[model samples]
Target: MSVRIAVIADDFTGGLFVASNLEKLGIPVFYVCDTAVLHEAADGEVLVIATRLRFMPPARAVAALDGLTTMLDEIGVEHIFYKYCSTFDSTDEGNIGPCGDLLIGKYGQRRLVFGPGYPDLHTYVHEGYMFYKDRLISESIKRSDPITPMNDPDMARVLQRQTAETVGLLPHRVLHRGVEFARGYVDDQQGKGVRYFLMDCVDNDDVATGATIFRHDHITTGADALAIELISQWTSEDAGTRRRTPSPVARAEGGEVVLVGSCSGVTLRQRDHFAQDNPMLDIDICEADEDILMARALAWADEKLGAGQPIGFSVAGDVASVADAQAKFGIMGAARKAEAILAGIAKGLGGRGVRKFVVSGGETSGAIVEALGIQSMQVLPFDELGAGSCISRDARRISLFLKPGKIGAEDVFSAALEKMRAP
Candidate 1:
């Protein structure tokens, strides 16, 4: 049967992250990172596509959604979930708002629910305000994000700046009223021309309530928080039949590499933590020519892999200089060059018998997969790092640990390495 659920995510890591959540609940899920393989047939119940549009312009994001929705419709997907970061990562002139509006218009779904509160991830919503752990998102370090800084904690105000549609709220109080009451609240909001509702969810139960109430065909938007409940509701009755055993972990040949490109404070800490146990090399792309940088990176990778030692390749400098790179090579051009270099490094390492990789940073992972010619990958929950292990679709079946810089523990790299080394 055709997939009933299809998720359009804003980045590579987030797509696999959501798929891993559903997969663990016994839902067969196919995570497609490259759009070219969107039509690849699968026996799975869900298909998650990584659009990597969060970093793009608003118009581009909308256009991408248009194409993705059309493809999903052709593939007979009955339900749509537009997944973004649990932190509600986006700019005032958003990729989230515009893309969400496009999906609403395409599906003729009167109301779309927006909740980025994944309590497990410490993201919560209170009175329509977004919280990171215990602090309001605006009060967090994300306020100084290099690309799309989140300055507002109010979900309504945050989305209002991106679209002309009326933004409404599914208050925490209404959620506690149970399914029917919550469903009525949604209808009431729709009557007031609120096309988008930011639903408040403080815990798993609240999210389950929202999921139980919404129709399967209704278009929902959020991180994987709501997905946990939705998948459970869909398969609860047939749990025994739908469930599958966990796949066996495979032994990794050759050495591994953890590539760091993001400049988030969390990534900085992770880099320092991982470096304490592994050899870490810094690539100074800004100071050298592209050719020289590539050559040096390859030489370093060769030395590490040749010695059977796990190593890390980190880009030197912070994200504050992103504007400088953009000024030098235009916004999109800068992104392209960065991806190109990272992809080159991956290709060089992979050619030299490196079978496993830990690619951090959303854009970096996306680019690395594409450069390595991975059209599609089977996603498995990697660890408590909130990342995913991916096996390429090709015969090589290369193994990868894709982590979005901000996610994962201080010893995430160590955990990933151990898993990869596990037989």
Candidate 2:
């Protein structure tokens, strides 16, 4: 049987790289992030879920991530691969460096992966302008900006070395990839099983088209189709078995539900998706003013309480930024409002009733818990990186954290709610 797999991230390059290396290992895998796409791709087999972290603001990108966390927790994923957002700047991924220790300590039966991820699109373009003004590609990243990887050679070296370390630590090389070319130098290269790879639509296509086609705008839509094709090569034998169809309607009632919409420009649309099963309100706490979110949370609680309905909230949103290094610095901005909601629910409980909040979405999970002073709340645990610290109480509700990049299937979110319910 092929090695089943799933990959999550804001971008696509990382997935291709992972798949390329894994293909050599003779392991089959599937790379996915979108809900519709992932559901279409799953097979009933032991699976690995690889998720990438970006350095953008949490508010812009946490919703989808939370959705993924919920799905992974409910359905269960075997290996946890975390590729921290890469940076050309020195302080790209601060405390996140120790993610391996974090996941393994908390969640049982899982592996650890940490990527000194590549720079986001803007960071690459802007910094590239400074690095290679001689070629003159895009004007957006003007020469005024300092060059990265070029000017800061030390940062590049650190990232290169760490990228290798990230892939080298995996249990078996059967289904692993090295973003940095040199990481997958394994001894058992002439091994047994078939190593396949996962890929999103765009990146997969680009890799398929290789040097034969290189246009100016062509790279924009470049996808790594070979990754998907490789997966197809392996999954074709037993795709029917690994595939799963989630329940159409939520298994439980959506009461006192908390709504977190952090995705940009598409807040109401995303809210509608959630509202399909539950009475969801579009509350993008990340972009909305902190005070506004607090007021909204209070109001949401009050409305639910008046109806004698226990509130259970689901957090979702996008938190993308131009330069990840600059935006994630003071992450407290995203944490405060989420903290308020958790605290409000806690206070409303009066230490008695069934006070439970189903926290979904990556940014919502991380920030909300942090706001209530809960440090390392648990989400979809991979290993040490998954095990976070206590949510230090600032007189707030109990907080929970979820991993990034996933689909919020009905069953998965339902499971999280079940975990939060009073035992």
TM-score of each: 0.93, 0.34
Candidate 2 per-residue C-alpha lDDT over 271-318 given as tens digits, one digit per residue, 9 for 90 to 100:
445456655444544455556655675666566565654344433443
Overall lDDT per candidate, in order of appearance = 0.78, 0.34
lDDT by residue for model 1 (1-423), tens: 456677788888888888787767667677787777776746555788876788888888788788888888777776788888888887776788888778888778777778788898888988988888799999987787666677889887888788888998888899998989888888887887887888887888789888877746558888878866776676565433356655754555776888887768888888889899788887656556667878898987766766666888877347656777767777566666767777888888888877888887888888888778888777775356565787777777788888877777888877887887777
Q: Candidate 1: RMSD over Cα atoms?
A: 2.3
User: How many clashes show up per model?
Assistant: 0, 73
- RMSD vs true structure, all candidates: 2.3, 14.6
